[model samples]
Target chain A: MSADLSIVRGKQTLGQRILGFFSRSVVNIILIVVAIFWLIPSVGLFLSSLRTVGDSSSSGWWTIFLEPTRITLENYANLLSNPTITGSFWNTIVIAVPTTILVVLIGSLAGYAFAWMEFPGRDWLLIAVIVLLAVPIQVALIPLAQMFGAIGIFGSVLGVILFHIAFGLPFAIFLMRNFFMQIPSELLEAARLDGASDLRIFFTVVLPLGLPAVASLAIFQFLWTWNDMLVALLFSNSQSQPLTVAIQSQLRQFGANIDVLSTGAFISMIIPLIVFFAFQRYFVQALLAGSQR
Target chain B: MTQTVVTPAARETGRGDADRLSRRSRRRAILIALAFLAPALVILGALVVYPIVYTLVRSLFDASGSTFVGPENYIEMFRRESTFTAIRNNVIWVIVAPVACTVLGLVFAVLMDKIRWSTAFKLIIFMPMAISMLAAGVIFRMMFQESPQLGVVNAGVVAVHDIFVDEAAYPGANIRPDSGFAKISGAIVSDDAVNDGSTVDVPLIGIRADSLPDDVVNAQTAAPARAGEITGTVWLDFVRGGGGVNGVIDSSEAGLEGIRVEAVDNAGNVVASATTDAEGRYTITDLEPGEYVIALPPSNFDQGYQGVSWLGEAFITGVIILSYVWIWAGFAMIMIASGLSAIDRSLQEAARMDGANEWQVFRRITAPLLSPVIVVVFVTLIINVLKIFDLVYVIPPGVSKPAANVIAVEMWTVSFGGGNDQGLGSALALLLLLLVLPSMIINVRRFREERSR
Candidate 1:
């Protein structure tokens, strides 16, 4: 009886161990599968741009590994030489950079005023800006286009840039104000006591401390402006059309020109990828700090 | 610090607070604001504020760029099929896309968070968010190609059938012998035509197959010959062999022989479809009251039934809601997660020691603390949804084909897509502004309240 009981006990222990191992193994496998599922479409998109049009149409992008000889860089080369899309790459940078910088600078200042200063109609003015936030761009386009045309900036790069900056301000202001409010008012008072002018104190104290918020705002505005197509379409002229517009024009309804489309799309998307990665740490930090009271 | 800074400015504009305001200091503030904000304000007022006013005024007028017709546009909008259809599609997009995007994004985020290279995974999933909507639309369009298999998807399906199906398995299959519908080889009969087989025998060989209608034969033969040239067995063999016959299948295949015709009503169908032509929209010809689906052309069968249902308005709501939720969910989750993480660790530890379970502790302690975060997330999501444009314009479902189109897309359609319907567009824009005024007020008021705390 004792011998039989010992054997049964041993078998039960082994069974339990196997169950635990398989359960954990299944979880790890699932995690990996999920990761691959998320990555495959993007990888497919990237690979499709590098392949010849025949191969792209003939098989799934994953099939490239089965016939690696089909890989080609001709698509990218063609895209670069394509006249219709060339200038928009540079135009996007020119537009995104200045707009991002201006939004950061002006937003921080306005945010400071809202956070620390006690003035009449301060709440009212801020409210007005916030209300503007909910107003969809479509509602504003026709009138704004007319207004821009009247002012002679319609269909111009400057006009597009101005629109992005204006739209970007409310969110920027809201975010920066939240950041400034968290700085412990005593710190600002300490800086003021050091005999610094408001300008000096602002440059020295408020600005430096708001770096995370500034960084995140810059990243947000950069992504928003860089990826923007509707605003660019509505406002930009041929000379000032951004990469989104250029990429858009490549899409022919009946014609299947995957070569130029994928290549141009990749080029257009690269800047945002770089910006996102470079400032990624700041994204998490700012999201944690700026979001909460 | 406050005293030291206040002393200089206070003395300079001493009682300037009350009216000791010197021209220099007041002018300085004005100039500074002008330098910093004038451009933005002017641009905003001109582009955003003014257009909205224009849209409002325009919507009240007639289509000829003429005088105020006062809600006539709205009435016409209700009356017009296109406007109503557009509205219906927009609503479907808004309702469906947001929830779908949000649910998918959250599931992805949660699943991805468990992975070792979480950020890398995020970058990949978020890749689509970076690509222009036009590109996505085009890519999906190619993925949905139709018959004859131009698209990869259809090609793949056809390739499977070729590999699996035996050539001789179904000699009596429903497939037509020729390209035309009339020449089907199966036993099925159409309402319009009946077969009356009459044999004409030829003296030299046998009954000639060419004497019959052209639809019955593969439409590649050069011309018909005299009767009694070939036996029935030989003709049947010829039909099967033509496909795999001597290197030239085209030579032996007959054209337009053995033809039949069928007539059916063409009512209740989406006869024509379009893509956004520079203005970013496509509409099918007026569909009858029935289940109709119109996907992007060239690849029609790739996606599942994205059916446009009855009362197109519901579908438009679905689309709008989908887009709204999809775009805003990430922001919502991020805010809520941040809020939850901000809770004091000690409170939880103390509660655990007091025999409180995780659920009780979360409900009692964490819920109250997270309220502020929840509010911000909800408010931001609402305001953002109110203003979002790209997805709405890009992936319009069935309903938004007409009048129920969102204020934003409506304005664009009227001004741009409607071909110089600027006045109507401007008037709609103004109505949109009025619609969003409440959210804006709430956002600003919340900002103040949050700041004070």
Candidate 2:
């Protein structure tokens, strides 16, 4: 895309080029200023995480610029050593992994069915999925909480994972179904005519063809479950809380120990950020797909 | 015609067999589809659909979910002040946060197109979308602390404030006991009025020596007043080593600079006023000979400008919304930026080639074209803010929780955050659903329309 723009720019005459340069520079300056404005809070969090407790409370994070030696790894070390912090981090992995796997697995199967297979009330069920996409999780929270309690999975990581999967499926199925709709029916029909069973055709043809959608869906589900707070907060108990819930618990404590808070928040943030940037293409593609839908 | 004449019985038999076989396969396909859909359908039914129905049913029940009390929870929710506050704040959140985010997003998206480092700029702007609301709440809470020393925002605010207006010079300054000064309505006034030619001494205490401004000079005694002029020295009476005499300037004492000293007449009007210098010396020249009470007005002892109480009851909701916008604006930006990229650039170029200015091009050609995407972003945000929970639940301090409450947080509080009233919580949840339903319907319809197209 940018290559095309540069090629277009090369054709401009000198006067037009100069005028464009000035306008672009003005835009550049504005963007830089806004970018810095956007970066301040995260920078503050990162810088504070490197500072000592007393230093964080006594001065703003920007003060570290004046005193370079104030930065330390003590906060991260302390946080890593804490059982609750490490435990919650592990719990996040436990919850997010299963939720992502189950959502993708179940959602793809259902999506394939909704997209290609013949069934009674197929259109009606698809419409139900569309409507379910609009259902806020709040409507289900209380009853689910009770249901979890009754089923003895309440406050367990399994419960949180289950809840995530349940809520995640609607969107997952919706996204996967939409993506699958674009797959040429001839491919599926050819596999079926070759004596491939329905499941075999799905695995042999549809799943392979739908890899991009699958990748994006997986990344989206992983990030959603990882960054989730409300579901984890309500569904999980102290032992099962994710990093988000853990950090929130710390936030509620008096005096808001910045060293711990920043460290925990940064820790909670870095993983998803790593995942996002590592899979940046898939992530953005998924976001655009999700929004366009 | 002769060839087909005797084939009716054979054709009927063959047609029946094909029909029966087709029916069997159709039934098999139905079974297969259901088999594939079973897991998702069961989970969705059990976790999503059933729970929604159960919540609706549970809302009518009492706290224990046993006894029926229809409409009572809804009535009680309306009656409660906190519920009203929650609803009001939710309305404010819905109205303000989304528009703020969308407008900012649109601006960033449009401007970003002209820049060279657009990707980096978009990354920074959209980075917050990756952060959890809990983390965002923590960051914002720390960022908006009241003290300039701690919070970067208040530090900037205080710096800007001091540039425009002078801070109180001698905040928390107080007169010594038995110093011939009386505390009158927060001001330190001389008990005895002085003639024009008389010199006065106003010795104050209560300021820590270390807290004084760095440029403060040692205390100095005032010179004798000449006729038609009054002179005075206002200095800290407390010495560093505690050896100074009460109400007397000591060599070790520091001057209270910039203290506004007013001389009031018997009729209570300020006759003359002067500010103390670095040496705590002030001279009221051209004063009348009549008796006048010298006063250190309360403004001198006023606590200097502390930055805004962002987490206080008055501003908590706004602060929460701001934090929300901070987190979600990037989502809006990225979405809108994608939309902006998808727009037909030729239309914009043609508009520009015409006599249209940039603003006109944007307003007429760009915006109308982008309205669908904008509405999608807007409606999505509306639905999002309606169920806003994390920042509202986390950002506000306990004292301002009520003020910052939205229906989601309120629902959580009632159900689990120590309220222990699930019925009321269920009602609030239902209310939230009802509130979100319209936007959801709009969003679903938009999705359907987009898919159809």
Which candidate has the highest TM-score of all? 2
| lDDT by residue for model 1 (B1-453), tens | 222333456668656455434545555555554444455456557666665566666667777656878777666656766555555554554455544554454445444433466556555544554455554544443443343233444455556754564121112223223321222233222223211121111001111353322334342322222231111111222343335342123434433211111111244232433322111112222333333222222121122222223224444354335334433444555555556557786787679668787569767986778777665655544444544555555444333345345656666776787457766665655555665566566666676676699
* Poorest 10 consecutive residues by lDDT, candidate 1 chain B: B198-207
Name the lDDT value of residue B436 in candidate 1.
55
Classify candidate 1 by CAPRI docking class: acceptable
What's model 1's overall lDDT? 0.57
TM-scores for all predictions: 0.68, 0.88
Count of backbone clashes, every candidate in sequence:
90, 0
lDDT scores in order: 0.57, 0.86
**Native-referenced DockQ of model 2:** 0.69
Q: Calculate DockQ per candidate and list them.
A: 0.33, 0.69
Tell me the tens digit of each residue's lDDT in model 1 across A114-178. Answer: 77775546676666666666667776676667678889999999889888887887777778877
